[model samples]
Target: PAVPAPPVPAPSDREGGRDDDTRDKLKQASAALDRRDFDLAERLANAVINSASPPKQRAAARLIHGQVQCIARNDQEAAQIDLRGLEGFRAMKQRLLNVCRKHGILGR
Candidate 1:
């Protein structure tokens, strides 16, 4: 009798799945932001934004990234950099807000 092999684990079951990694990265970014490490926070938040997660997670990641960008803008010594960062935050906020509104998650 031929025995069937065991089925492989789904993509979500892999170690550090997409959602888990995204959430972990978001936490790391938040910690970096709290420490005033704007550069590291931006990197980590961007990682979460670029992760292969669902729309809700992506929106959350964008919000975090926008926050980091806002912090960076406040610390910017150059006016050009500050303006650019502000623009980036506005765009990210708008995009995430649209997503949240569509999903009915914008209002409590």
Candidate 2:
């Protein structure tokens, strides 16, 4: 008896799967941040940034990246990220910048 070939995934399905993985990565990065595991968070954020994520997702990833930089006192790198109220993370960007300013890490 001939065995049937396995079904192939549709393009949308593949994209959806990728999206899901991105979401999972974001969640894990956020969790790592919460745990103060900056190394892990940075790695995950880098993965997201290097991926073909939508702008908003990329922004979120950048947010994570920026936070890690700030926590490590790498203000120069943090400020280089163009996180100015775009791509759906406006509040976080503003808040983070404000915190950086208060900490004297970010110059006004």
Backbone clashes in model 1, listed as residue pairs: none
Task: Assess every candidate by TM-score.
Answer: 0.53, 0.75
Question: Per-residue lDDT of 9-107 in model 2, one digit per residue for the tens?
Answer: 668978999999999999999999999999999899889988998877877888787777777656765555635523467676776676566656666
Residue 23, candidate 1: alpha-carbon lDDT: 80
- Model 1 lowest lDDT segment of ten: 74-83
| Candidate 2 residue runs with Cα over 4 Å from true position | 1-10, 82-89
lDDT tens digits, residue span 31-72, model 1: 887788978877886776566766655555556555544445
State residue 76's C-alpha deviation in candidate 1, in Å: 12
Predicted structure 2, TM vs. truth: 0.75
Q: Candidate 2, overall lDDT? A: 0.78
Q: What TM-score does model 1 achieve against the real structure?
A: 0.53
Candidate 1's C-alpha runs over 4 A off are 1-12, 74-108
Model 2: which ten-residue window has the lowest total lDDT? 78-87
